[model samples]
Target: MEEVKFGQDINKQKHKKMNQTVLITGASTGIGLEMAKQLAAKKFNLILVARSAEKLQEIQKHLQDQEGVTVKIFAKDLSNSANAISLYNDVKRENSKVDMLINNAGVGLYGNFTETSLDAELDMIELNISSLVALTKLFAQDMLILKSGKIMNVASLLAFLPFPYYSVYSATKAFVLAFSETLAAELEGTGVTVTTLCPGPIDTPFNTDSMLTTNAYKANKPMPASVVAESGVDLLLDGKGKKLVGFNNWFISNLPRFTPDFIMMKIKKNLASQRK
Candidate 1:
């Protein structure tokens, strides 16, 4: 009996080592880049996808030299509606198993809806909402078939509010939060787990590129990208359904769910005033 138990333990360890590959979208920069670094450090085989082949090659080189992890790059524009499913098909062609999926490819338009170009806003919707939903469904079906997998969707603190300037971004994140929560419930019996990470003000390229840091209020309350990445990954691995990155963030994220709308609006108004 002891011999049989020891053999089972060894088999489990071997299986864990062999199936540590993760596919992360938008991995050329920002949170996705940081996540790739973290996962590689843990000896996971990585498949990094982004629009820029040059940048993806740079990250691949760094990971290969630094961590010696198997790193593959897929350069594709995820904003294209069919690209998400195309990505899945490409990965399967490589004969690689996706043990985890990180749907982090998203863009934000930082102006009033009317002020922002219709085309750009539509692209934002394609990247942030449509692609995420598609990838989650595509890869998750594979995971379901294998009877094991994990998913982490990067949401935002804006998910808790209907903010003025970042209207579309907030709405997309709200959809992510609700969608991930419901998916987690449905997949409970399946060996698959989903975690939506609602991080508050991450300090990364996302801030500068998305015009988030330009906001005086957000720029002042920035948290390191590594901190958010680590916390988010840990929570997802631990099977935590939903996690807001910081302690204060968790409080504030839940606050809107309980606080009266009129009171919340009053607080938002006061906060907006201080920023100006």
Candidate 2:
């Protein structure tokens, strides 16, 4: 696929439908929150989802007051297996049409399989994989009926490789990356687009707590979560399929394919050492 250039002209070129609704999961913080702010700035009506109702309400007020966009908050734990379809049903019950779907709700678990609890891994799989897929099915069908919409899934650089410690996290992201590319093709000519935002080590609250970044090594360049969110939105709106966040990340993420497994392994080992 061709590399999509990110800029402002692309954003202004697309016109927003009056009161078009955008549903964003995990919108209470980090990249999801920034995406909500950017979309609200463009005057898209928003339905924000996350576990924290209080935080969501606060963000809703700020975005509505500042950007003058219609905003709604759904305080639900996306990690729950049943909540995915329930969230979709709630949106339908509220009579909101989903014009854009952002599958940004996810979690990460670091350490050996034995070191991570079964419950945590189950939760990660349900949220990062199952819930994401469930929500996509529901919202994509909605978009298919409308014959116009966009879906952006937040994947990670690890989607391209098998990380030593972050095995489950990488696996979940791989699913997202592959699913987004294939779905984009399937939805072609339907006036709907699906994009996977494969950001590398974003400086978000999520990464701050992860050993994947702390122990493994330094990022060649770490972008702010807001930058990733804004650029991702721009790419998806421009009908781009996949996006690499920072320039160095783009290079490093692709380098493993050409570099020997031994060298990549050493690099990953060094990076993992930083966790402690």
Candidate 3:
């Protein structure tokens, strides 16, 4: 693939349909849901994927009614690599021409690596890394053929450094960050852009899960999901390769370079200890 310069005008690309379609995984809630809402307002059709069919339908109806945009729902557990492939096949079968793909479905297991469930850690790897790669591969092919499309992969602030209790989760996000960057480079002039969003903690049900509810977790305020979603979508549309959602997150992501390894590790460990 030839290397294309960044910041080509996405609005100028011609699509099969007058209105472009954006397929977002984990669209039932949180940042993904907010992305859907923001895009709907922009008149882009949406394909919402998640594990909750009921929630997807509710969002589907709401977007359709409020924004007058077409919304399709696919409820599947993407943690399974096979299901991720199935999602791509199903979208092709439906003849949905996706102009953008958002890989946002992920889970985190917070605990000491040794104490965490190995099975759950494996599942997280599958969902956060493998499934993302699978979906990106499938859709990127179509986008290549069309010579136009966008991809946004959701990483995390944790990707920049190792977190003690979030060892596996942080590792998975690091993979996502590295993978997305390399893939973006490979697809450079292919008329397809890959953007990674590395957001800090967000106030959402995802953070409310059992592993994340400790008093230490509650002590740190989280950014609003809507804020992260808006910035992510904006950067993706702007053809940026990677974005950290907030100033503090951006600072922290870069701080590791200047800080000593031992100091960073100690700070991370101290932060991790709060989860109990």
Q: Per-residue CA lDDT of candidate 3, range 1-276, in tens?
A: 123422233434433333889999999989999999998888889999999999999999999999888999999998888999999999999989989999999998887778879988888988998899999999999999989999999999889966888888999999999999999999999899999999988888887465455543554458888998999889777857788887877887887899999998887777667454
TM-score of each: 0.89, 0.90, 0.90
Off by over 4 Å in 3: 1-18, 209-220
**Model 1 misplaced stretches (Cα beyond 4 Å):** 1-15, 209-220, 269-274
**Model 1 clashing residue pairs (backbone):** none
* Most accurate candidate by lDDT: 3
Q: Write out the backbone clash pairs for model 2.
A: 214-274, 214-275, 215-271, 215-272, 215-274, 215-275, 216-271, 216-272, 217-271
Q: Tell me the tens digit of each residue's lDDT in model 2 across 134-205.
A: 999888998898899989998988898657778888899999999999999999999889999988876667
Select the stronger candidate by lDDT from 1 and 2: 2
Q: Which is the winner by lDDT between candidate 2 and candidate 3? A: 3
Q: In model 1, where is the ten-residue run with the lowest total lDDT?
A: 267-276
Q: RMSDs, each prediction?
A: 2.7, 5.6, 5.5
lDDT of each: 0.82, 0.84, 0.87
